[model samples]
Target chain A: MKRILAADIGGTTCKLGVFTPDLELLDKWEIPTDTTDEGSRILEDIHQSFKSKGDDHELNLAGVIGIGLGVPGPVDFNNGILNGAINLNWMEQKPIVSEFESISGIRTIVDNDANVAALGEQFKGAGSGHKDVVMVTLGTGVGGGVVSNSMLIHGHGGAAGEIGHLYVDYNRRFQCNCGKKGCLETVASATGMKNLAVHYYESGMTDTLLKNGIEAGTLSAKSIVEAGEKDDALALKVIDEVAHYIAVALSSLSAVTNPKYFILGGGVSRAGRMLTDRIEAYYRPITFPPAYENTEIVMAELGNDAGIYGAARLVKQFLA
Target chain B: MKRILAADIGGTTCKLGVFTPDLELLDKWEIPTDTTDEGSRILEDIHQSFKSKGDDHELNLAGVIGIGLGVPGPVDFNNGILNGAINLNWMEQKPIVSEFESISGIRTIVDNDANVAALGEQFKGAGSGHKDVVMVTLGTGVGGGVVSNSMLIHGHGGAAGEIGHLYVDYNRRFQCNCGKKGCLETVASATGMKNLAVHYYESGMTDTLLKNGIEAGTLSAKSIVEAGEKDDALALKVIDEVAHYIAVALSSLSAVTNPKYFILGGGVSRAGRMLTDRIEAYYRPITFPPAYENTEIVMAELGNDAGIYGAARLVKQFLA
Candidate 1:
């Protein structure tokens, strides 16, 4: 029974999963991320957990094949180095794989978390059976991962899937956190939705549920999506506007990569088919004809577990 | 020494070249495109030209290896099929590889001209020594080609490099020829520059050299570039505006593919560093910081010979 250890490292927590080579999860847990001391304790903590699997989960590590980690920033996958991961408080490049492999006596692999999530989706979620998939995560800020021909496109400097930074509107006066004006992240993320609702409310529009929510200080992307689902005009308008930006960005992406499926995930995607259906409606017309006919947009299935699964996939690929 | 035949098929003319395995051009010539019969005579003319190469240039075909073609449309590269090349009167999918291979008794390969041109640039032009390159041609219309890991990204339907159709301006009222509004092609092409000049002139900003050319019906993208070179304010404004659009589109592209270099080519690129330098100026601020720092924008060096050279490279790759 060959097994693998996988970790999805984030700013707040590190999710650890034990999986069989067949991709079946045997155990999963999380630990608070220790960002103090330049995150020096992170790898040691993971190694300790791996060694204590017998005590923690009644599972032995004697059959472990390797470890795969998904980190929240650019990664030099070829060298298993983490490059400038702000969330981890590591400004300098860190040799991630060697550190873990030295402790565990096993091979290790690391990749950007977004890219890992995309690979997870391609492997077992909404993008299953597709050789090419583009996954967009509409969270606090948008993140993306691209898999073409069943392989991740790491691009030069490992910056290939930075989808949220795409400039979507030249007219936007507000600057995105990335120091650009009108990035897709400013219009398509959960924060963007709230801002859009506020912008509409501030523009002298009244007599809408969203305005009422704003007046009550209860305005949120979830509330707006809930209202839009009920056919509220203002909420629907905000959703339509957000969908337009996302669809336009996806269309532009389609023209360049032409992936077979676009998997929408993250906190915002929990709005489910309401968001996907609207995005699809806007996507078809803007995409090039040939690509429009072939590419399909769908919601991700694995939810919060995608990252760990993707990390496991990374190890699986290494084994293969 | 073994040699190869390469053809770059265009609407008006088909350029043919003979190249040694090392990619040196042995001979080159062009013939008018006979697109009168669904482009049926096009291949025959190419074959006749190839057969007569010995008499015209003293180049014997006894050592010919293969033929590589660059066509003006989407191609199913695996099967060498051309899909709806409007410029070539090829509305039906044509099995170009087998057709040419059967006639010449040699292996044949086919790909979109833009993709081939990108490969050509990667092999010997400005993109030389780079494994990842994105080439944008601002001809009458914008055409693009992408190379990642030294392989052309054909996408799902071989329409991957359709960068021209990316919607850049949501406020645009005029539709592009692709039946979309605000496509990058609507602002980045030679025709797009002329249209921008007309748009500015129509907006009542008179007293410029471009206005005089427009009044004389001689306004062209080249004339606009020339005027900008002379520091004509309105022409510079138009050039700046066009450069802004190109920069934004390239920024969006960088966020996704993050190629090492962007190779700008075609008739509009004849403006040389004047255009590329301005585009880089605008691009740096909009692109993601890491990608902006690593990626460069440069001009293609092969000029009209790029397509033919790229075609020859295709055969060389096949041989390798």
Candidate 2:
């Protein structure tokens, strides 16, 4: 049975998985990313990990068809280059795919991590049944990927799915890490939820669980979601505000891409129906008629494994 | 010497054109749309126009390979159905392709006018030589079309490329024709420009050409552009404000679809470099880094003929 090697490389961790030709995951694991040398050792670590996994499973290395990698940055997929990956502390471009292929003796493919995750969901997760899917990951920052006609839209510079950077508010004073003001990420990410909580608390808007949590320095996106789940007014308000920003961004995206399904993933999305239900409520009123009626908002199903699955799926597409 | 017949069907007029297989316009003409009977005679008018053109030129009817049409509303391109084209009083779905094919004895294809126009630009106009292009037509209302990887992106319900409907301002109180408030169309269209002029005039801000034009009931998007060309204060303000909204919408779109070029068309685009120059100025600050550097904004080369040319391009694709 032939196998494929898949890797999802993030800023802090590198997730590796082995899958069969049929796409069944044979094994999966993670290792801390060694970013000490401008991420020069990262590819070497991934290669070593692949060899160790093969040894542990007593599998033949020659039986591996290819390796697929998802990197946390804009990827020049056609040229196999990772460009200015900030998280990995690489300020310059790197030949990621070539290095991995040379070390592992197998052909390799690479793409942006968010795009890979979207492909993962499209292939076997929440977006499996839909050919046109837009996946937004609400983690530390909002990340997005679009798959149209079953092909990922990498745009001209591989910067197509930067949904988090969408400017939602013009009057906002808070600056996004990207040096822009009013980015959707400044209001929709987990940190953005906490900012909303702090803004409300500093405005002296009332006594509520969120206010109390903020005063105690215990306010977090999760805590706010829990309080909202229990019907806390302040927490619900924060959730509604966050959901409003996300819904507006999604509505704007729908008008442009008109995807069939919007899959919400990442940490903040774990708030589940509470988040999606509110998003749909705000979305329906703002989206164009036909798109509003045709598109569906759903939650991610693969969780942490999405990147790995997406990476494997990349290999399948490459081989095909 | 084979040719293609093309029609751009709108609410007020029907534009017909004959083109060589290489897409060069051979001849073109227009007729008022007789929409009295649910657009029943629209197709017949197009047929008559094609026959008369053939007669006038003494061309062989057998040399025409196909006919392509661009309609005002949603289209199911696969089955050639135009769904509820409200502008044409087509409240009921109609099988447009078959009707035209049966009457002209030529194969027929149809698509939303915006999508077809984008294809036209992609094939031989401003967007020519680019595989991924986004075209936004700023007329009475804004309309848009997108081409990705050389194919039109007609979302799930053929509703993709509705860029005009993107919600750009949540605080806006003016409603769009689509029943939504804060849509880009509410601020970026020709009507939207007038509204902005009126907004500043009514706010009691200052003395400017726009104020005088409004007092004389001569205020128009064209007049405002003309004033801005001479550096009129209020007129430039209106132009800047409209450019701001369009830039924001384009930035958001770039984050999602990341097309290589944005082609601005329709009547208002005749404002020429006055409009595009400002749009690019405002676009740079808000767009994601790589996308901002890569995507270019330019005027449509085909002008009013874009729709007819686009319609003809559709036939070329079909025959290919």
Candidate 3:
């Protein structure tokens, strides 16, 4: 059985995993990724972890195959570089794959982190049995990855499936982290939810959330969901709108990448049926005729493990 | 260079072409498509065309390699069946590839005509050197196709790349052919232009177009552009707004796909730099940082040839 090392690099943390041929997670570990301090150090840390872990396995495979690293930000996959990470102080283009290969003596592959999560989910989570899928990650921002016909859709610069930027409302523009406004991330994301909560609560409406010491200030989308599940009027208003926004994005996405399964991942997705149920309700009615019945939305199954599994799967396809 | 048969099936016309491996066009023809009377007759007609072409040259290489047909509607690529073609009155699913293959004694392939156009642009048109691209067909209605990493992304059941149905407004909704309202199609499509023009023409805005039979039922997006080029007030207002709306859709697609190039095709795109210049002017300033300098919006070169070229390209990739 070929054992491969999968690494998922993020702005906050780096995940390392060793998986068997059948995708069994044999071992895993996490490391703080302060890409701000020294970006090269993070790459070294990854090498050190690989050396320490692979020695423990002492397992051998054909040429050690390839390592798949899913990084955050716009990446030039052909050049093997992480162009820049806004969260990280990575202004200078860094050659990630070659840097790792110089020390590890193994080939490497890469894609955007959100895309990797989708791949991971397809390989180990809710989309396990599905061949084509679109996964939305609602973390600090809304991210998306698409797999069609058993392959990842990485656009020109490995930034394909960046769903955060899809326009939700062209008429009433809303500012986004990308400096552009009215993007899907401006509404359907955790940050988006919190923003709406503040806007609504500030609009003056008595709700259980405010009475129970819940304020949009110092609150998150997660908190809003929590409040909504407990029947908070304000939270309900915010979430219903968010669900509708997500449905709009979903229908839009379905139009572009007609997939049977729409996988919802990331932190906010933990709300489960709370999000899915609302999304489905809104998604079906507004979607174009044939698309309504042809697509399905489901929560991601792998949880945090998706990144590792997806990284591993990347190796399987590329290394082979 | 191997020779391949390519066909583009549309609502008003069916385009057939014989292409060489270098993606050079050797010969082309056209036929009106209304298969409601007899579906199978279309195949026989195509077969007769092939026979007239006299494929006495090296037509059969290994497998004689399938004909490529681009139909105007949803399609099941894996099964090579036309899921449904609303334009052609193809009510039931038709095995397009098998039908063509059996008649011509060569394997055949099929996909949504828009996707084929995208493939054509990527392979031999304005996006010739590009690997990842999004092609928007701006005719009476808006249609889209996305290609990532050198592969055309056809999502579950070939639902991927339907950008026209994406929602543009959350509050001021405009009904779309897809049953959803505020779709980009409602504002960006040529049909949408008529909607916008009708509103403007009826609102007491006197102009050359209205004076020159625009209100007398001689108005289309084409007439609008011709008038706009001459600085017609109503035409300028309508075309500029359409250009901006199209720009917004481009930004949305860029945010998601991040393709290196956006190939603008179909009838409306013939507006030339008038359309592209307007989009580029507004798109760069309005989109996120990552998109500002990365993607390019160019007119498609394949034009009518995209359908046939794309079909051949699809079959060629599978063979390669």
Candidate 4:
């Protein structure tokens, strides 16, 4: 009765899941992430939580086949190194695979969180039936993961799917935290939408309900999306502007990876069809014809569970 | 002692190569492409030429393992379909694999010319020893091919490497043949360079050796590169502009595939260090940090023979 363990390690919490050898989820739980002491205690905390769970459930560690981890930064997949996760307060290359494997006496694999989330979607979410898929996660920052030939592409530096950093804002409207001006993340992420709203407000077009939020610097993507749903002009304009940049990024992605599905995930994507429809409108007229005609823009279905599922799927793929 | 044959099917001529199972080139030749009658006789002519070559060289058709083709158009690799090669007058889907196999009594594989060329470079040219590579072909038209994880990525609709179509010109300066405005191809291809020279001349910046040629529509990418070599201001300006757009496209490619080597090829690449150096300069500050730091821009070594080598590489991969 061998089992698999998956952990989606985030800044504040770690989501854990237990799966059978065949990848059926048996159990799932969460534990607060410890970020103090250079995040050195995080791995031990995860290991101890699994141990406690095992004891409570009469689960034996020896029966675990492997552990798969989704980390919150770029990963050297082959080497199993998590490279500099600032939010996790781990700014150095951590030997994730070796540490986890040694701690649990099981084989372990690690990949970037966004990449694993994409793998999760490709396996069971919106991209389930597609071999080629691009998952764009528009959360705090826009993130991307590309799957080609049914395998995640890590690129030469494990940076193959940094679609958020793609150059899109031609006017250099906002500077991305990635030290680049006019990145896709500057206008398409949750923060990017708010930035767009502020930009619109500053441009003397302040005739909207979002004006108070924009002026107070308290505008949220969720609020803007909610307003847009109610036919608010500024909110719709902001959504359209964000969708345009995203569409530009997707069009460029089409010319590069040309995936069958562009799965939109993250907080920003919760706007649903309103965002997707506008993105499709902007995407179709500009993307490479073959790709534009074939690729679909769909909402991600996995939500918060994508990372855990993707981690489990990584183990499944490894077993295969 | 089995052999593999590769054919690079272009509009004017088809370059053919014979190779051992080890992929060492044994012989190479060329035949004029008969693009008349909607390219109906193209496959048959290739088979006949191969037959003649085999007869003259004491080669037996049965000893050949397979034939690989590189066609100058979008290719449905799995179905062996050429979706529409306007230059070859192939306006409809042509069953290239079935037609070639039936005509020559050999197994066959077909891929896009730009894609195969990238595979060729990845196998033996500047990208040798690199699993992740991208090849940008700056010929009459800009073409691209991406190889990730040491394999060519044809995308869902076999349009993965259409880097030429990436939206780059923020000004929407020129209309692309792909029915899009502001495509990278409109500003980076050989003809694109000529168009830029014309645009510059029309805008009253005409104090160079290219003025008469631009006015007469006889301006060539070669003249521009040579003039740039001699520090001609107008030619340098055009080269810089082309490099800028190409760099923008490559930066976006970094966010997608993030290959280790960007192999520059086709006729315009012969401008050598003058072009690649400028492209690297523009690319470094803009692409994703990891990709920008790790990826190297290099010149294509195989030149005209890249297509044939790449075509043969396709068969080798198939056999594997």
Number of the top-ranking candidate, with TM-score as the measure: 4
lDDT, candidate 2, A1-320, per-residue tens: 58888999988999999998888888999999988878778888988888877775555667888888998888987789988788888889888887877877888999989999999998899988777889999987899898887788877667787889887867665678877778889889988998887887777766787766787887788898998999988788888988999999889878987888899998999998888889989998988887778788988899879999988988998853
Error at A178, model 1, angstroms: 1.7
Stretches of model 2 off by over 4 angstroms after superposition: A1-5, A18-32, A48-65, A89-91, A206-218, A230-233, B1-5, B16-36, B44-66, B205-218, B227-234, B315-319
Measured against the true two-chain complex, the DockQ scores of the candidates, in the order shown, are 0.60, 0.65, 0.61, 0.76
User: Which of candidates 3 and 4 is the stronger one according to lDDT?
Assistant: 4
* Candidate lDDT values, in order: 0.85, 0.85, 0.77, 0.87
Which CAPRI quality tier does the interface of model 2 achieve? medium
Write one digit per residue (lDDT tens) for candidate 3, span B203-312.
Answer: 77875654556547767788788888888888888778878878877776776677889888878888888878988887877666675467888888866888888988
Q: Which lDDT tens digits does candidate 4 get at residues B90-118? A: 99888989888888889999999999999
Local distance difference test, candidate 2: 0.85
lDDT of 3 at B35: 72
Model 2: how far residue A150 lies from native, Å = 1.6
Q: What ranking of all candidate models by lDDT puts the best one first?
A: 4, 2, 1, 3
- Select the stronger candidate by TM-score from 1 and 4: 4
Give the lDDT of residue A179 in candidate 1: 81
- Per-residue lDDT tens digits of candidate 1, residues B238-303? 888888889988998899888899999889988887788889898887778866678988888988
Ranking of predictions according to TM-score: 4, 3, 1, 2
What is the model-wide C-alpha lDDT for candidate 4?
A: 0.87
Regions of model 1 farther than 4 Å from truth: A1-5, A17-32, A51-66, A206-219, A230-234, A315-319, B1-5, B17-33, B44-66, B212-218, B316-319
lDDT of 2 by residue, B205-273 (tens): 568866677998778898989889889888888888888899998888888878888988887878877
**Candidate 4, residue A188: lDDT:** 92
Tell the DockQ for candidate 4. Answer: 0.76
